[model samples]
Target: MNLKATIFGLLVFFISGQFALAQSTEIEKEITELSKKKWQWMADKNADSLAVLFHDKAKFVHMGGTWGKDREVDIIRSGGIHYKNADVHEVMVEVLNENTVILWNRITLLAVVGSNEVTNPFMVTEVYVKEDGNWKLADLTFSKLMTRD
Candidate 1:
């Protein structure tokens, strides 16, 4: 009966692993699409939409300085820093748990800072947390890269 029990345990483990993989894949797609929408929203200066997505205590890191959600929203709304365009070259998502995920994006960003427009290649890291059934952005950091492909 020990051999039968071992076989049953193995089957259960295999099935559970498959389920987890499938769930992670679904989350990956959802996050990827959400990220794409976020870029568009930033370009359009849709601060309201972004406000909903960003957590109240979210952190935003930039070349100028690091700030919180409110400042970021205001900057976008006021056009102080206009996100003109974002060309996403690569996207990767890691689901840490059901409630948390981390995403990395390699992008070429065009922005208007004050009166001058500039372009930069960056590797952006975004951390998302699921709260009350909604995925909220918790932290976003931009790391400037030297070369662009």
Candidate 2:
């Protein structure tokens, strides 16, 4: 009886672990696709799409300053900083849990700020959370890369 019980417990555990792994993979793929869409939206200055993706309390950290969702949206809408393009060099997504994920990417951005075009390499970190069965951007931070691309 004892041997049978142990075997049953081990089987349950193995099945649970496999299910979790599969779920994580699905989440990673979802977030990766979202991240790519987000970059394209930024380049296109689609504030409406971004407004939907970003949480109300989302925070954005940039080389110049940090701000909340409203401010970031306003900046994009007003063309304060225009994202012309983002040349992504590499990207990675990590599932922190069932409802949270983090994405890291190395990218070179071509942007226009105050009539000046600038291209800079950066390592961007983005955090996302699932809310109401949808993934929303929670936080974004950009670290300027010293190495030129």
Each candidate's number of clashing pairs is 0, 0
Model 1, residue 55: distance off in Å is 0.4
Best by lDDT: 1
Report lDDT (CA) for all predictions: 0.96, 0.95
> Which digits, one per residue and each the tens of the lDDT, describe model 1 over residues 44-131?
9999999999999999999999999999999999999999999999999999998899999999999999999999999999999999
TM-score for each of the candidates: 0.97, 0.95
Q: Give the C-alpha lDDT of model 1.
A: 0.96
Candidate 1, run of 10 with poorest lDDT:
140-149
- Cα TM-score of candidate 2: 0.95
lDDT of 2 by residue, 1-149 (tens): 69999999999999999999999999999999999999999999999999999999999999899999999999999999898998999999999898999999899999998799999999999999999999999999999999978
